[model samples]
Target: MSYDPSGNAFDFHGSSYVALTPNLRKLGGEVEWDNATKSATVTLNGKTATVRMAEESVTVDGVQQPLSGPSLVKDDVLYVPASFFRDVFGQSI
Candidate 1:
């Protein structure tokens, strides 16, 4: 993960975590952030995943799914679970 002065990137429970923007891009997804709602819209492969900070619920392709972990925000950067790509995008890590 790239360094962020804001301290939003780190490792937890043996999983590496980074800010949402980079994670989205790494997954080949386009992201639109909504600061007001503290949510992110990620689009890839004709699917949309809407995730809200501090929420365990994610909407993928207009269907709601329970997340293994909540989406978190620290220092204004959104942090998603490391398994997000595998869980939400159907990709192996």
Candidate 2:
């Protein structure tokens, strides 16, 4: 599904999916993509989540959890599900 980012929520790709950089960074979360692993490491506060773009699950601090959908990268922006914030970072989303 496509995302929409607006205010505290989300809007789709022009404004962008979860709008990664702007919103996530504001939340004190950082994401780093690894081309070799095809996965991203997301750190928020002291929590760490590993999202593989081709997989529908995330590993948080060594714990594996299912995600609403797989993460994605398009036009160089990372698009993770809103549920990611809730499940991984303990944010309400």
Give a tens-digit lDDT track for model 2, residues 19-92.
44556687878878798987778789798888787577889899999977666666556667676787777775
In every candidate, how many clashes are there?
0, 5
* Model 2 score (lDDT): 0.68
Query: Which lDDT tens digits does candidate 1 get at residues 1-93?
Result: 344566446665555565777767776879998889878999877789999988988999889998767777777788877677777887644
Q: Rate residue 32 of model 2 by lDDT.
A: 84
The positional error of residue 78 in candidate 1, measured at the CA in angstroms, is: 0.3
Off by over 4 Å in 1: 1-16
TM-score of 1: 0.77
lDDT of model 1 at position 4:
52
lDDT of 2 at 12: 38
The window of 10 residues in a row where model 1 has the poorest summed lDDT is 1-10
